[model samples]
Target: MRRIRRMLVPAFAMALVFPAVLPAQAAPIRATVKSIEFEGMAAPASVKEMADQYSTASLKVTYSDGSVKTFPLSYNRLFKTTDSIGGTVAGVAIDHKGAPIIDNSVPANPTPYVSDSPDSNSLFQVPGMAPSALGGNALSLVTHYEYITFDNANQSAYGLIPASMSLTTLDQNKQTGELKPTELNKIDFSGVNGLWIPCNGSLSPWNTHLGSEEYDPDARAYEADPKATFISPFVQAYYQDKTKTGNPYDYGYIVEVKANADKSTQVAKHYSMGRFSHELTKIAPDGKTALFGDDGGNTMLFLYVADKAQDLSSGTLYAAKWVQKSAANGGSADLQWIKLGHGTDAELKVLVDKGLRFSDIFETSDKAAEGFTAIKTYPSGKIEYLKVKPGMEKAAAFLESRRYGAMLGATSEFNKMEGVTINEKDRKAYVAMSYVEKAMEKDAKGADPADDIQVDKISSGVTYELDLAGGAKDRDGSAIDSAYVPTFMSGLVVGEDLAKADALGNKAAVDKVANPDNLSYSESLRTLFIGEDSGMHVNNYLWAYNVDTHKLSRIMSVPAGAEATGLQFVEDLNGFSYIMSNFQHPGDELLLPDPLKIEVLAEINKSFENRKAGGVGYISGLPSMKQIVEAAPVIGDDNPTDKSLVDLRAKAAAAGAKLEWHGKNKDIVVTLGKHSLTTRVDSSTATIDGKKVNLPAATQFSKGKTYFSAAIWDQFIKL
Candidate 1:
């Protein structure tokens, strides 16, 4: 085995190559901070005082070759009062005649509101609305899903930003911190409201961005009067006619957005996937199977199989059941998929069009008993049960997916299913379970002790890998026997000691990952990037774990109050692979800040507090896979031999070049601009525009695939 000495270079270096041998055991890769850069104007004191305004920062990487590049970052502008649309920044008021009036006027060019409280003072005031119902004034922005077009003619990258409307502020008494009942404002994005709590999303195989709308209006209220349900008086006034006819049913679904080259967007919501507090949605390689994770207590893992590939408008949704194989916590479980029923978006839309409310599906009196409705015995010694009532309308099943799953007997014991990422090559999906509490005691009551399969202990979170290719048949004609194992478990906090944290959060440690949230994997690097959304860490950090080496390195730390999210691997046209991420909502004090010595704090106060300045921004930078594994003399069998070419193809695409191979000529050709390089396999000699040149490492064929050496990349490719 050869050892590679990795050296850190300056921030502007184009590349940094490690000496580790490829396909062989290599030394652990360590992260070195090259440089931190800031963009956009400094947030105003008013914005800084607010809990929502987190600063957006972009990271620049200097590769081993000294080529420096930065990932592009952008923010969405808020809907202003002066906008021509009838949408109002302030809340709406109902007149004496029972008509809603929107106050769309800008208040004498009012300055941004400053407040002592961490919540923003900006208000969307509705005169006739109750103050308790006024929502916060900040534009809701949360996740970013990057869509890359692979077309050579129109290669582009578009970032789809979804506003997660999780929190809103009604009027509050400044001195007493009490809710003000008279004046209230309902927050609305543009003129369109009701996009509450957009959560993590995925880029579909068709290149569309799918954003999940998490959380819903008060379920009880909606169930009572779905036609006139209002989360707040302000929301009631703002929604007006929509709420009058049961519009709450229209909000909690998955939205699909397609970005145009001009930076414009076309958006639509996929109601057929079912309405729930969706944390993540991943489309499998087949493009027909979509796995969804619900982010809440007593949630169900959903599977949606589209009627057509690349089309999610219509689908059959199913709830998952975990048949416990072991009683131990975080142990393996055999997954059973139970069909929750199916409906097309158009079919479901008819119900909404006909003023059907969520309450129309199931009886409100039965809400407390909404789990595992029917039990069926199978001949194969397997028993199946319906989590939800069987006779509910399919439209209702789509509208109230969580409830439907529950009534169909799906396991609702999983807590906070955060992120889902699929490995195309392995045909497996990785799901992050933010936390697992002991099985539902309510469901366990009066049930057979042997039949209860829920674990007995609590866990911070565990990443479970589901085998996509394997499954068995259940009596209901559904697939069972899908095996899942815990791959990563969050570190535990004990005795208030943060420094003693361990990988599984079973022990305390200062640098350990607490709550693992957003996840992304790099095939070329064989590494998984995990982002922290935990309060255990003073400053949530982003980490990278090598799948092969089992090594985890903390790469970046978010400022105070922000969680690390939107972890993505993007290949630019220049052949560089960059990690794009964001620090969401800093300065809110979700967790205790790292203890700072008085002297150090005083000294830092003289400059500025990075943590105190909160605003959303992009952070990108990381070495390419080829550079990390170039040092070893011999490649190992575990590493793919064609890894270099795979990376080269990404680089060439980024660089506006075409990379292809001519089997007849046994040559690899890369054309960029007016220059071209043609290297023949097994030949040290090559031709650059027909001029003969000696190659450093001859291209070799292994396992029926051509493998290009790092020397070819370093010597021939300009990048």
Candidate 2:
């Protein structure tokens, strides 16, 4: 079934009214500006090395005054070996001591974050500038959380493996959004016990990088068997100390990294935000309210509202209870938040430094014992018997949050809750469900707690839309501090599973998304972009869905067995448009032990090229931002269409200027209204009455009339 939507007007132009009907085509093959439309390159062939193929995109923008301008952009992949066509190239790995893993004679060190590992989240900085700004460009810092670290040193649990996070300085051509790498440095993570699979990330409201550590080794599982170094190779490699188990509590929190003016970084692990497979965190406009998605089966959703603005060091954490309202199509539910004990990062870090154990915070049993809470399935689909010990609730909330929330009755019914992004203009948020099976569906094995999310299994997965609102009171009747509180969630896009596999061994529909991962939204464009991390598709795709039009367009696709990630949009970067994305683990085997995996691997081998380094890239355009602001007055609009014989008075208003004409002909008196008498307009020169000025353009007229010429106006704005 097709979903219909209304025009999501941008905040900048609330007064502008759109037509009653928008374009009906889901996605077109052409680009048009009158109405927003962009049909990117054709999808790659099934068994092709599609990574080498490039695409072109066009974006037509409509301004507050109803002026229209179109921007054309080029899309391509980036590697250490490749020079950036538009922006900075990524894919370099560094050690804790800040040395490149592999030598780079080339500008971009091709050593992937961890050799042969996937490069995860990418953040491209573009700060808004003032109108009167002059000279110089603002250096944009491109940051990436290298997913994992490995080299010749170690590939197994017993070997030494420490990951890295890199920050690259890219001086931008604001007018074009083109970038040139200036300096590259690694953000040291030794202070935080090192990052574990630093996965997805989001830009904080105050312009910092908010990232996560995903799929941390189970803390309780480690407690049961201390010798199981295979369970946590990261701990064994990073810590290596027989005396220290390497605190599991330290490895799964929101890690914040800030790059300073000197290319130095400030790194902090926000332990107050709860520990789990934190896929990512998105901060609302208020800055205090943060929504974090846990990536695993039977997971929980968490919300953290900071005690103060722009500070994640301390916050009040809340877990979600899925109050199912429907059973069909991945299930619709009203979210009820459970208040969990809060702690500051400073306090939580102390407990972690003391090497707190799972037994210290919670008591467990195979079956329900006296004072023990009922057994609840963990996010990994394993049933866990948990009972938060008295005086340890605060510790459990930060150390073993998913278990603590489940003990408190917050529903752990979600599966593969991956990525999240908010559309403040629409007061809505989007979440990616990589898979929609397991605990979310009916249980075959008998269980104690009831299944709140009993629904059909979806191998391809579902993407949910959550409604955000203000003035939402909590379960305890106290007002939630966040204005952007999520109230309900429903499947906005559901992927269909086919009984028969496709020609390329794809189990899901090609048109619809399979295993949607990173989600990013552009408020100005009213578009939600999605990336895929799927085993169902032989080749994963990147998509752009117009919220106002409800048209989902397959914009680009990656090579076979690759995970498309970090789909972010910059609607206006100094009047230029940018849509950035990156893919990783190309040519890897499709996840499984099935015969179909063998067949798919054989087909992928035909066009796939294996690389020792991870893949990191983006799609972009470049114009001089410094040039745009300087030319605003003379150009009027970004793409000015002033007539050949434009009237002097009419041209001034179009140039965003306010000027009054008192006299006409050779006796013309032009005043800025503030000046009693400034200058008089002549046939080709300005005569100073009170102020002296120069008129560069001579008078020209169409149909025997005299006015200013439109030619050469591209570089001037008469202030």
Top-lDDT candidate index: 2
Q: For model 2, what is the C-alpha lDDT against the true structure?
A: 0.63
lDDT of 2 by residue, 419-483 (tens): 89999977999998888887788776656475777777887888899999999877777778888
Residue 329 accuracy (lDDT) in model 1: 41
lDDT of 1 by residue, 1-719 (tens): 00001001112212333432232233322222232222222321231222232324333443333334553332322221111122322212222232334322244442211111011111122223332434422111123211111112222111111122211222333332222222213322332344444557766766666776665443435555543333433244334433433356666677775543322345677778887777658787767778876776566778787888888888778776766665444455677667777788887777766766544565443222445343311110112233323465586478767655555666666666777777666556777665544342224554422233455443444566677664545439755323222122222111123345433222323444556777776654555666666655545555555554444555556544456655555432132344545543344333332333232233322322322222223333343434333321221122333234434465567667888889787678888655566666677545544445444456666665655555445434442
Give the number of the best model, judged by TM-score: 2
| Candidate 1 segments exceeding 4 Å error | 1-193, 218-220, 225-246, 327-329, 364-391, 438-453, 456-459, 470-475, 478-508, 590-614, 623-719
The TM-score, computed over Cα atoms with residue i paired to residue i, of candidate 2 is: 0.75
List TM-score per model, in order: 0.57, 0.75
**Candidate 2's error at 270, in angstroms?**
0.5
**Clash count of each predicted structure:** 59, 12
Model 1 / residue 702 / CA error / Å: 34
